[model samples]
Target: MTPYAKIRVVDASTGRGIPLVELRTVNGIRHVTDSRGLVAFHEPGLMDREVFFHLKSPGYEREADGFGYRGVALTPRAGQEARVEMTRVNLAERLCRLTGQGIYRDTLLLGEAAPIPNPVLNGGVMGQDTAQAEIYRGKMMWFWGDTDRTSFPLGNFHTTGAIATLPKGGADQGIEFRYFTKPDGFVRAMIESKESLPIWVSGMAVLGKGSNESLYAYYAQVRSLSEIASSGYLKWNDAAERFDIAQTFAKDRGWRFLDGHTVQHEGYILGNDPPNVRVRADAESLLKAEAYEAYTCLDEKGEVRRIDGKPDYRWQKSLPPISSTIEARLVREGKLRAEETHFLPLDTEGKAVEIHNGSVHWNASRKRWIGIFGRKGGKDSALGEIVYAEADAPTGPFLYAVKVCDHPKYTFYNPVHHAFLDKGSTIYFEGTYTAEFSGNEDKTPLYNYNQLLYKLDLNDPRLAHAKT
Candidate 1:
């Protein structure tokens, strides 16, 4: 039996394996590095022949050869190994796949020891979507929408939950997940659905004192990808270790959903993507929709009024904060000018970096609010660009937004900055890396629609762009 040549791609400086590097043969045979940054090559016709391979990876670079081609010439031999090194160009360094199978597939295939104890499959889960997390019950409680199972095409759609010990390694070391699974071994629904529509959970947070601490999240029942039929809130049942519907809100309930990172400031939880809407940190205020207040410029009647063509940014009650969607509509309606917008941070190009979705947290090191957000309607690939920005306060004037991580032809969206995992100036974040919104149809094997973790140093000179 002939073993295929094992090709490995690693970071030139660290000599650590890099994931998602694309290598293409001169004739167009394409290969991507797996979680452990490996590709097992076995092209019989090209095995003996010296082939020119093109290297293409986002946030990484290799020098061009004499003919201006940035590729390597390799003569792959059976039962052998080859190595390629690339310099990480982006401030953010992609660590590994947080969800999905074959995390260390090729590394394991070569009989190498994996980083995590259970590298192949942790929860018997194939893949999972956007992660909503909170530090709860002395552990990191995580919930995700629409999980994929190894056994079938369909999977747990209501919600999937997992719990892990609070990360102490700043996420450079891969964190482990112990999934909430059913008897059949697939991830069980955090909350079972009684309707035909699927339930996707988000806005997870923990409330109350020590023994009285409780977990909660906002759930939306969807008729399709864009159409959410109904929305509601849920509470975690400590005894059953799952979520139960606490209150079902009407579909017209204005964007009072605590949708992203919830930061406690001045005894109130500032739920920020907008950071404008918030409720008192107490258990009772969080459950009541009317109790939440919006930091809006609107009058009591919920009307957008401009003073001398400028938005009067102020705190108003019972009104929704100007979200990205609302900002876009107001701009089109000539109610809000581009220059007066508050939430859309700007890149170095002086272009307003339209943000799709993201989370913000107060970083103690910087003493400023930091955000990791996905770009929207930019020249870059759709849903593939990520930007980092900071503000003096959680709600006002994000100085600048700069590119931190990028996926050339892939979609990496809904980036969640894990403030709980932050160590000094080093920040850890993760996002849903998928092919769904991306025009490319080639789903990354064992990795698509899953979370990919990345880390960045706030002191890095490259990030100085955003700081300015």
Candidate 2:
């Protein structure tokens, strides 16, 4: 039994009691708030619990307990009063697939890299000789485990396999196929195999860069062309393990699929045809505002403009694409220097740039930054050498960052997350280690055993760091 609080939940709109409402918590406990909108619990175990409210009367819809609701921190004290209200819920308007806590799918697959001391190397499971991968659709996000080529005849028994996790709380592991193709937005992986066996491949989206310490995956299952008509949505789970909420939310209402390229939904398709906002940084607050002198080194070598003839200057609002002429006014007598734009490039166009999480500050040590790049070729993961860049600030106006890993014919290396240890000036980046799959490896096709994390000395000079 639970003790009830003598509280009243009056309707905000009608000012009437919302009688007999049941409240539930995330931990599977339920209590009822009375006609006056007051519900009480005897125990306060976890402060992190989220509560939900439901009414037993008609015309009243479910509600959630918000910050306004109060609970004792584990004492016999006056708890906070909870208010309840009802709103109409349209069955057709489901929660967004990307929103909420839900499971999408799960899959079983093996992960491996070359056995060499370095994760990147040729003639191994993943062919890339460097730690990098490119951003291309139809590329495999992860690969199945493969045999150790060194073990020869015995290695024959150890084959490779792949798996994909669907969005609806289910997984397809150990797919029985040799070649797999994913048509954007079709929701299913098309399989080409050695035998006519029913093969299934799990589908998942990688949430962040390929080199992040770990890939956060949302598993999704296939929705055949037939199922699309009845189920107005397609979905993937949070962890690619279980189906919890509708993944498509509302996007599926107007959905279409292209043979090889786009997944059309809500009048939009996925591609890089033109200039759009590809990447954005977190909003940053301005520290201060000021103005600085402008210059022109042309034949005259003089000021660009003058306020009143005395070396005119103005306070400026500086952001990315710092090569523009946007200036601010100096309200005070302080010298205003332009804030240097700090950003990382997304592609060759350099249109979409994001801020780099600064490097670790070393208390006592010299350091360098190594850049490795690669691309997927045919079936192998071909890679370039490790480039180098050095800067006092991890966020840089880097004089020279190595493009040692640049291979025009190969895909550019996709660097995930990087961490610099200020204590030792050591830097580490993790990502999938892949190269062109030569097709000579047994059992597994192209993407067999394709994940690896690379570590390097940030202060190493052989691989020169970018000069400031």
Candidate 3:
């Protein structure tokens, strides 16, 4: 009967009705016209774009434009319906539509323009059927959620640190400059060392649920007690299957440790080979699987360190070489999914947005939310505030974290985006810090942005806490 909607068509030569002729897209969609040569398809969303539709039948040279085609483009900030027309194809034509493309920079309204969707109600419930662990007074929620069916937003925080890798011999475990993630989604992780001034950063999805749990982190600015004060980029190529933080300059840098040295290390023995073992396995497997390989490493090691013997590899040029580290993982409940490379290729916009802070401490006593701190000006200033939304279930239409607020500072950095609170739970908050009136760079942005992290005080009417 009727497959979709209806449109009109006319014969070019006879200027008469081309009744009964089949209409569809060249990609093999079929539709039938009525007595007036009119037919329709079932679809929407088209504006300022072009499209192609085809006409089909048992063999006459098909005409594409004879039936007249139409197109529509995409709106930068809104969604709209795209009306189109189909033309006959002499050589098998089809209907097509175009979409608008460009960079969109605007102040996203809290309840209206929030970028991330609420996972709890959006069917993004992760870790539903897997083992879940709550640590630090529910500050850290761990579960397995299915991201494939859910919508998750990502964030990028820049920082640096060191990653130690254990080689074939346990004697050598060296550390490199890198970055990682904080439990609270900060891109800064301290190594608890005064002699080494390195920081860890992360770039990954801030909010996710179900089996789709994933994060990307890195350690960087790795240096000795003396040379630690410098702003340089460190590029690391994971293609070498390198893992564990080892000292390439030390005598035993390349060696692995077979026995335990520290009390914490006493338990993990044979089970632990070296940091790079798994990475090497992965690199080899990938090399054997794919016809091509891609990896990069910066000369930022201070001293170029190369392991001897058939280290089992080849070398490739390091693009944007910096002492950057990537930590990627898929947590399947308590079980960890295979660790994949963390550094993702730049997007069409050429901006690295998501980051991870693997070592960030979550002080629930301090606040239920985490604050994302960034410089006031420069490219980072473009970072908007975080927002959170909530709904009753995984299929809910979510509401904003802040019901109403127009203040320039607090509202600017207000928590408005959603992040995974746990496997099945999530919270929404905002980033972006306001400069202090005192003009004190560090202290101002610190207090302004850092203090943004706070629990939804039930008594606080300013926040969009659970109603009723």
By lDDT, the best candidate is: 1
TM-score of 2: 0.26
Off by over 4 Å in 1: 1-4, 27-29, 42-49, 66-68, 78-80, 165-170, 299-310, 328-340
The residue-by-residue lDDT of candidate 2 on 295-409, one tens digit each, is 1111133223344533232222222112111111121112222222222222222222221111212123454332222222212124322234444432233334333222122
Structural similarity to truth (TM-score) of each candidate: 0.92, 0.26, 0.22
Model 2 stretches with alpha carbons more than 4 Å out: 1-386, 390-395, 403-409, 417-423, 430-453, 463-467
RMSD for each model, in Å, please?
2.7, 25.4, 24.6
Find the 10 residues in a row with the least total lDDT in model 1. 164-173
Can you write out model 1's per-residue Cα lDDT over 32-108, one digit (the tens) per residue? 88777888788869997788899988789989988889889888887788889999887798888888887877777
C-alpha lDDT of residue 62 in model 1:
85
TM-score of model 3 relative to the true fold? 0.22
Tell me the TM-score of model 1: 0.92
Give one digit per residue, the lDDT tens place, for model 3 in 284-320: 2211212212222223342222345211122232222
Ranking by TM-score: 1, 2, 3
Ranking by lDDT: 1, 2, 3
- At residue 409, candidate 3 shows an lDDT of 28
Candidate 3: C-alpha RMSD to true structure equals: 24.6
